[model samples]
Target chain A: MTMKRLINDPYDVVEEMVEGYVKAHDRYVKMCDLEEAQGRVVVAKDAGTKDKVGVVIGGGSGHEPLFIGYVGENFADGVVIGNINTSPSPDPCYAAAKAVDNGKGVIYLYGNYAGDVMNFDMGAEKADEEDDIRVETVLVTDDVVSSENIPDRRGIAGDFFVFKAAGAKAAMGADLDAVVAAASKCNDNTRSMGVAMSSATLPSKGGPIFDMEDGDMEIGMGIHGEPGVRRGKIEPADAVIDEIMDPILKDLPYEAGDEVYVLVNSLGATPVLDLHICYRRVAQILEEKGIKVHRALVGPFACSMDMAGMSVTLCKLDDELKELLDYPCDTPYFTQVK
Target chain B: MTMKRLINDPYDVVEEMVEGYVKAHDRYVKMCDLEEAQGRVVVAKDAGTKDKVGVVIGGGSGHEPLFIGYVGENFADGVVIGNINTSPSPDPCYAAAKAVDNGKGVIYLYGNYAGDVMNFDMGAEKADEEDDIRVETVLVTDDVVSSENIPDRRGIAGDFFVFKAAGAKAAMGADLDAVVAAASKCNDNTRSMGVAMSSATLPSKGGPIFDMEDGDMEIGMGIHGEPGVRRGKIEPADAVIDEIMDPILKDLPYEAGDEVYVLVNSLGATPVLDLHICYRRVAQILEEKGIKVHRALVGPFACSMDMAGMSVTLCKLDDELKELLDYPCDTPYFTQVK
Candidate 1:
């Protein structure tokens, strides 16, 4: 029997974890607008504070400390979450913005995806119409592969780069336009691509979300358990990095004069050793490309619950962008340079 | 063909991880003690004030934020770490005391095991004779499993509980003897027992140092990867809880009138889902026993580094014990209730 348990049916599991994660980490609660309804779980940094520039970012729940985890001082102002991969409803996003905004405005920044765009856009539009609170959004479409063919690229793991880059500028008294510009600049300079070995099993689905032979893994797997660009057999860390980084390096095509920030993200169960091995090769590869890596990070920045694989992100940077990129933020999943 | 590459040399993994864990969690580095060694790692926290009672705890390198991880304000005054399961060297312990001591003597409180006892004793003897700081030692002989008949009633996961209770007493400026008495009392009241699905992979060993079948799990496993009291096929969450809770409850033999503090600790790699599932059952089991669980914590409190198992600890409580138990602590691995 393919063993599995529906997480929703076991409502206690999510509730218990949310309560514990919050208690262990920090205080986070649903935005008043979405608290009554079951859609968005908007969380504010200072629930005690009346209003501020509501900075909201969220997605599916599993990649914890990601969407919800990172909402704290010098980080996100609020977070609005939905089921894993799905988008939160209009009410929650609107609720989150209103709760944090002190008539200044709200910035809804998240990965670019159809679902999130629909709901968050709806939320933003509704906020303007219903409450007259100005809401602006900067869709972070940073994925090299998905965005390559489409006019507007899809957002991937690199969204946090933008979130932090903009989050710091915003938290440090940047106005709504400047904050939006900073977030969009991050979106322009950033590109992320990932791969997976062994499909991840969602809490609701006991079986692997997709099938891959023991000897094979898929490249370009989506963070939401979506299919990847292609499949390949087991390979050495160097060889795998070649597969992941070459496409990224080529697509972004950093010139010899360019400087970039590198992030090696794990998709859940890919061991840290593998992350290091991959990064070790990446350092060499970038050096070979004669591209100066100003800074790099290797960790489970964006994960697919228990998925086993890794991703690489490169953010093209200049002097102005570099300082903002180096800005500090403390989120549950991602901690920026401190 | 289990293929892997070390994040560092297999030899340096433990020490490197420790260094990394400490840097990431620097808040635990205490008031001052940074200059102990010319190029030495910062001795996290020192024994309160030398004049006040000092509580020192130590053990292996891996389990981050544990023995070493818990040494900070509201926590252990200092930590003496061993290489893996090996106890801390006498030199470090002696140095740690001298660094932390103000005028009063230091008290060495650690798990009861031959290695820890011998080394800690040596350090204590040397510190008392040489340094102006007085040094005393107390052994936590809690495990109901290990008995005199079994060569030693060894200390194990239950050390943290006893430490917290004792550390709180010491923090209140208790005298050395009083701190030792309080710590000893906590140890006597506390008991822990765990089950492991597999043995931990020693850094030197490329593979797991011990073995269990694919579907088999052992009951009553120790955090040190020591053989458990029993081994068996996988059990349901309820069955797992029953096996774990029965021994802990039986060992302590709690009375209907007794109130208690409970902890559900993940060895490592066990998801929060499993932790919460186990915690839920643990709370249920305690309720059925008519034992009031006054305080509860469920997380990777005391882990065995990537070992997939959990241990349950219960400290039968009274008013005095409860007050100490409720004291606040900020350590890498634990944040206690105020």
Candidate 2:
């Protein structure tokens, strides 16, 4: 059992985590009890701005500070939680929309996955049927390596940037269609690539979700042990970043004279020391390419439990995107300063 | 080797990390190169507040946000870097004071350790003799389990609260004596205890810093593999918190009607999910004791770089301590909204 997780009962992880999260961040969020939500929804206490569209985001657990961590002022209004790596049921997803809607309508945003799409779509249908509240959906497809086609790529850490942009738009009183467009536009421009040196430990499984040799690494690996582009012996930090950046750069064709926002994110278990070392290389690469780094974020924005690796996310910037990304927002895990 | 860390050359980690940190947080800090300071100091760009005492804090390198992460607005103005698990050299310690000092004076705050004391003292002596800058020191001895005598106990996560108090005082234009007094008072009221399930992997050694079986855990362990009070099989989160909180509470004698600032810190690989679960119990115990939790912080405040464990720190508070703790601060790793 290479899994070194420190959880108590495997079955109680989600509930306990929810209880703990709300208690620690009660100033920002509260537990919501919709008829069939089963307490799986955590909504921002001050949600439902009078004329603003409600922003509801969610997905599986284990990725702390992702869906739930983004729920706060000027961010997502609520988050629907799921079990470890599993999608939420339809009821909670529907309840999330019902919880935050203020007559301007609601938007459901999540990473692109078969399970999440199915569940959230069912939720949206239920919301429209039961209350006649319109709900829009935006699927984040930002992992450039997952698929070559624009809409098929899976979302990874790029979810942070895309969600922030859309949330900012919604907070600014954008209508439902405009908010969806903002999210879709952000997703289209964002690109992410990651490498995993070790698999994340699953609480219930009581072992590694997948296995790799001690000195090996998988480049372009998905957050949930999904297959990557290549597996080989682990390389130096510089060499690894070189390998990762080439594809991300070419996919977007991020060229000279381009300015961008950067996010060098830890998958988990990787220390801040190494993340910065990785960021140093990223900055050097961007400089060499004649690209200007507008603003940068380096930490565990999205993580896969204690997985030992990291990812680099680049969101090419325009005036609107920059303002949205830099908007002041606060949550337990992330805060942006004015 | 169960320990898997992602870094480049082990010997160059400190230098590379410094390079990465300054670049990633260019908004708040900059790398300093003082002729006598040996280029191991990172100072806040907004340091050198006129008429205010300079606050310099540092220790070994493994604790990421602790010694370095807290150096910014209204906090420690500078940090001296050291090798992994080793105290910083005398030159850099002196350099940090020189970099941040304005007209008033400087205050050096760090955990009570022999190596840090010897090195920082040499630096302070050099400052006084060569430059005529008054330098004062306050040793934080908050790890109640490290020793029965208050001054002999080691410093741990409580470093955060103490440094913040002193830094806030300095930023408020307190002279050196007043700043040191504030730091000393915070240290007197703070206590911490931690459990390590697995040892942190040494970058230079390429293995665990110490030995422990996979199923085993040590209670009251210090950050750098110091001997703990008890070793036993892993327990549930509640039971483990019960064991940790008993000593901390007893040592401080935190009583009913008292208020405290709680920090449930992940040593490294423990993740936020588990930290919150742990915080739930800490809150439960404090509530049952009629101890009012003025505020709570749960996350990887001080980490051991992928070491699987956590620690709890409580600063029994008064009005002064509460005001200082809640004072506005902005750094890459920590921020306060007020």
Candidate 3:
């Protein structure tokens, strides 16, 4: 199929998208004006006003609402943006730390990806050496099947849980180390797996990043088109959810009498109708296992721009995680109130 | 491409989706227990609790967040759901009125579609005859190119604005007549136009509802595969926005000094990255016209399942409209807080 995106000059997608984003959501965010981070860093309007530890989360650009949309009151304070499916350069990462630092400290949070790790580490070093601003990092690794070694697994939709916990913790005036521990705890309890029916179309490439037969699906696929554990004909929502849920349930060993926060997230192009159908199955499975659902969020929280698929993330909750997850937040794409 | 939806039986999609929706958002909504509307009427958990005019909105099933997701505190008190792309039967409509109505009265709001108009009218009549409860309605007609006469036009993305204004007004303890007036005023001031790059696939048919070359687009397309004004090769985002914005601006004749609320909505498959890109052009054009944007919402507020398209809706705001639009509400899909 021909790539049919509503964009101008494929090469300019990221720059143009950033321009539009800040304009549309001007009340929530503004472009960071540091010379080195002109179009790459988005800072919340209230970023440096509070004495709380600043929360900075970022990664590639295609996943809208992940890094950028979450930057607002009581959420992520700043974001370092990159090109589609690519890590932000070191300068923007460093610039983000500078822009949001409130003299207390700043915590950097994002998915586990090699490029991201290298670039963010460099940014952290610059903050320490040049500016004397303390910064901490917590890598999210929640895609259970990506690696048997949990620390090496790729972060997917579970990034939302970790970021929310950390953001709320920071907003509550937790010190840098306490905030990092809160984020690390959320990451440790979260598990995610996804099934992709089609690959997302790349703007610069002007085609899908990968090819799959129209009726096929890849189970446990990574967000950036990384290989999955299995690829075959599309199955019913229940069958697919069962397949994905088995690994997540077993890996976390989420037992009966345990409570969890459930997220049935659309990767991108999947309709809300389909996501709810999938959510129904997930709820039924949880009920069968006697696992309690504390709260459930269903929609596109994180996306792989225009990819046709969905992912399920379950965060096993203790009292602290539950309180943090339910904390009031206001953002362009997410909002909660007492 | 084959239709790759993650669903069980196509016929059971609506039932299962409702089952999932009520489970996932149980904090805000519940299944209406009227036997006549079982599985069809979704009622807000707080419905009829306050002595204010009841707000009810709904249409078909495919537009996920449109009718269902908007049911919660200070939004629609109840929703009458239908099968995919089909209007609700009169029974469910009457059931919604009965479920939500306080002693004050009830108001019905939905997009302007012939089927919806006929059925909701019948429902209102039934409510008056059988229950002696007063009911009023304000139909939203915002698609600029749907007809020469404004009231005859179909409602598309502009449904969100009209619904919001009415929901807020009713929640502020307005009577039925005042709520209807607020919704009517919003519908009158709103204008919208859309371009579709691909047809939405229908689950029952197991194929695209209509066919077009992958790289082509139709300007001013309706949500449910209705005919659009022009069909040709797809163009850049700016060019397409120009075509859509011209008609909306001319139809509403939004003046240089007017302040408006803008919604750049994805039909379904369009990415958020593209929507913001579209919003940037919309903002640029409005700036050139000297029309100030009061606020902007860019996302899939309404959709045609899996259709690759977007629409821009502009609601010229008066002080009254502005105040009502900004009123706080909490629903599963949309939330705004002071």
Write one digit per residue (lDDT tens) for candidate 1, span B1-338.
13222244655554554444443344456333334322222355444443467677776665543676567666677776667667777777777777667676777777777787887787777778887578877676666555633226666667778888877887888887888788878887888777777566565775676766755687876678766677777666667878778767777567776898877766654544456567667776776878886766655566665566777788888888888887866554455433
Residue-level lDDT tens digits of model 2 in B72-144:
8888899998888789999998888888889688999999999999999999998888778899999999888
Residue-wise lDDT of candidate 3 within A205-292, one digit each (tens)?
8889998988999999999999999999998999999999999999876678999999999988899999999999999999999999
lDDT value for model 1: 0.67
Give the Å error, residue A138, model 3. Answer: 0.4
Q: DockQ of each model against the real complex?
A: 0.13, 0.63, 0.87
The iRMS of the candidates, in order, is 6.2, 1.6, 0.7
Give one digit per residue, the lDDT tens place, for model 2 in A200-288. 88888878898888878999999998999999888889999999999889887677999899999988888877888899899999999
Ranking by DockQ: 3, 2, 1
**Against the native chain B, what TM-score does each candidate's chain B reach?**
0.90, 0.98, 0.99
Model 2 pairs whose backbones collide: none
Question: Model 3, B296: alpha-carbon shift in Å?
Answer: 0.5
**Would you estimate the TM-scores of all the predictions?**
0.71, 0.98, 0.99
Q: Ranking by lDDT, best first? A: 3, 2, 1
Error of 1 at A235 (Å): 9.5
Task: Please give the CA lDDT of all the candidate structures.
Answer: 0.67, 0.87, 0.92
